[model samples]
Target: MPAGPVRTRDEVVTALRDSAGVGMGYVPLGAAFGILLVTSGLEWWWAPIFSVVIYAGSMEFLAISLVTGGVGLAQVAATTFFVNFRHVFYGLSFPLLKVRSPIGRLYGVHALTDEAYALLATRPHAQLTGPQVLATQILCHLYWLTGSTLGALLGAGVGLDVEGLGFALTALFVVLTIDAYRSAPDVGTLVLALGCAALALAFVPGGMLVAALTAFLFVLLGRYTLRRRRVA
Candidate 1:
């Protein structure tokens, strides 16, 4: 079958094959989110709904608890913003511009999951065609959808301890973090991140994640500005 307009069969196959690694990670992680959501008292159908609509990896897991616990809109918004604050940095390197069409670009941005970002980021940006990028993302999304659906169906039939399930995303992040550091080791950036975390932990223990992310963002912006000035 044709992958999409302007894409060859070989390219489509390659994209699908490349996305298989992402699928491997996403399936289990998505399943964990699915199992946690259902076990937390949400309907099995809600699993697919969340996977389709939200698609925010770690945040989706947190949303299950927030939704079940009857969190207010304000709290949910604040929590979501803080939890996903790191995504802002993702846009800096994401190949969003490679996607030619407006609709494809829109979906590309929406479907830019951590797995997709990691997979695509490893590839040379100029080497990727719009269809290849979109196809890979779509395949990853399908993997997540399939996993979540199956997991929700299974959770409905049997009881399981979901406490450990939450670690799936964490483990994925750890692996990704290691891969990122190995690819481009930077002591200054590592030290900055650690310093931010330390300051957050010391000053705002209850809001450490938010404080750390906010501080890191500002520090990154400052660094970028300084580098730009030096370049000019």
Candidate 2:
């Protein structure tokens, strides 16, 4: 594929501005993860390693416990797969085609977090250049790395009991969801998502996230097919 257009100065600024809010969330949340990891008895350096290697925010937390508990490899793989299965759906609309360089595309895939998806996988940023998209992801990753490293260092020194820090992830998701809703404001899609969640909770509570995502994915494909047929 051809390389994407070179990013302009304005595009660079735009990417920075776009990632700023996500950075704000990531710093504290990553700090929470770092602090938890340190307090859980892991070395402070492991925090950055986890952020760099794992990069999956929620799964990284689960991984700390899994590692400390000595969970088996197969079980850990399964857990990681299920926890991040939503990324399959995320990829369906993640604007990756905008990033045309092979190297840029590879890193973009690796860095595709919820925050990046929320910021770039939308109409507003549809015109983002490859460099712009890559820059946004890079900035977000830096924010997370910095936050986790600082938190780990602090936790190792202070050993403070920072309860309720895990809730930062949930708070960040809520904010992103609100922003997503505000951007699109599609009542039908919102209602469908809620309905899918309700069904998943009612019938598959143990696998609610997977079930809900599956149901929503199928319903969305069905809607798309129907709309295409109507157009035809």
Candidate 3:
């Protein structure tokens, strides 16, 4: 069989729109993040710098407070690990390992924001050629970079409307959570969420992200125990 056409302008454009479709909310959120970074003590240009280089959404936000506080490197490293070690799970959840090259693999890994991961994974696997995957990741990256840079450059003009933009990510996550619960039949998951929420309310420092991860871990452990019981 002839190899599928190398990603052309048309495919790239489609990927851009597809990627950017998911990024629509991200743009405003990223811009708001930029504003927060600027307000918190980061130099204006650092907004774009971190967004482009770190490419980790929540990490950038955390770093803002950390920087202002003069947090030590070890503390920052520890924080990044606890907060984003979940990316480690992405390797298991990833469905696109088969088609990509080493370079594409690296790029995809770097681009794995929560929004991008969901958008990319839920896509039909066959639909994404390497070029398409690269295109999608690039679009998402550029969206963050552009949004951050714009907000940083124009921080003086930012107004209250930005708070609504920041809520877009929360709203998007809410929709995803509702969808998960709607179709889920697992009793363990519901229990785990409640348990984690309780633990999170009591202990976790980073807030919602940590709480959600804790909840997910509870569900995983519960499911594993149930499976073992069935097997034994």
Candidate 4:
């Protein structure tokens, strides 16, 4: 028999207790998102709407520019797919957990943020349970929705501190970069990622992602070529 499922509390305090430290992280990130949304010309209501409807923070940011620049849906969708391609990998690790319902799977996709993944990934594999996962996802979405709306609402009153708030997204990217580099045991891969970042900084204008992906492929090819030569 499967080790039975865990239960989620039906209220806020329980959700907070379950979420632990992740809530603190979500607050500021959510605030920054709200500010970004308001500054980008989205109506205050749209802040919460997108936060709920799209729910992909980075993609939401990208969407703002896409909307303002008059980019079509096709281009916007392509960028979003490229940017979030890594989420596909998240599915691999937690693919067959205890999610037993269609709605749970639906919520699962909606709640698949970087923070949520990190939190759940730490659990002992078999020890993980359905309700706990749902709780984490629900709480995260709520926090994001609330924080984002608050920021946008506040923006209408007093406006955003542009310089300071812009750093929020930059900080997120830096943290992600550090985490990714730390994952590869080989220093060479780290160096390659950094070099690619620098090259993007130099040559790619609004094309940083394209550069990064290219660099990743280039590094892989170089590694393969070296191995093939040695074998030959």
Residue lDDT tens for model 3, 70-162: 999999999998778878766566655743588878878888777666656655666666677677778888888888877776774553235
Model 1 per-residue lDDT tens digits across residues 71-127: 999999999888777677777888888888999999998898887888777667888
Greater lDDT among 2 and 3 belongs to 2
Best by lDDT: 2
1 or 3: which has the higher lDDT?
1
Winner on TM-score between 2 and 4 is 2
The estimated TM-scores of all candidates read: 0.82, 0.93, 0.74, 0.69
Clashes of 2: 0
Runs off by more than 4 Å, candidate 4: 1-7, 10-15, 166-232
- Evaluate model 3: give its TM-score: 0.74
Error of 4 at 227 (Å): 19
Cand. 3 Cα-lDDT: 0.73
What is the descending TM-score order? Answer: 2, 1, 3, 4
Question: Which stretches of model 1 miss by more than 4 angstroms?
Answer: 1-7, 224-232
Candidate closer to the true structure by TM-score (higher is better), 2 or 3 = 2
Candidate number with the higher lDDT (1 or 2): 2
- Report the C-alpha lDDT of model 4 over 5-108, residue by residue, as the tens digit: 22344333454675655555566777777777787877888888888888887887777788779998899878888888767756766633667788898889
- Candidate closer to the true structure by TM-score (higher is better), 3 or 4: 3
The C-alpha lDDT values of all candidates are 0.83, 0.88, 0.73, 0.72
Cα error, candidate 3, residue 69 (Å): 1.6
lDDT: worst 10-residue window of model 1: 1-10
Q: Which parts of model 2 are misplaced by more than 4 Å? A: 1-7, 124-126
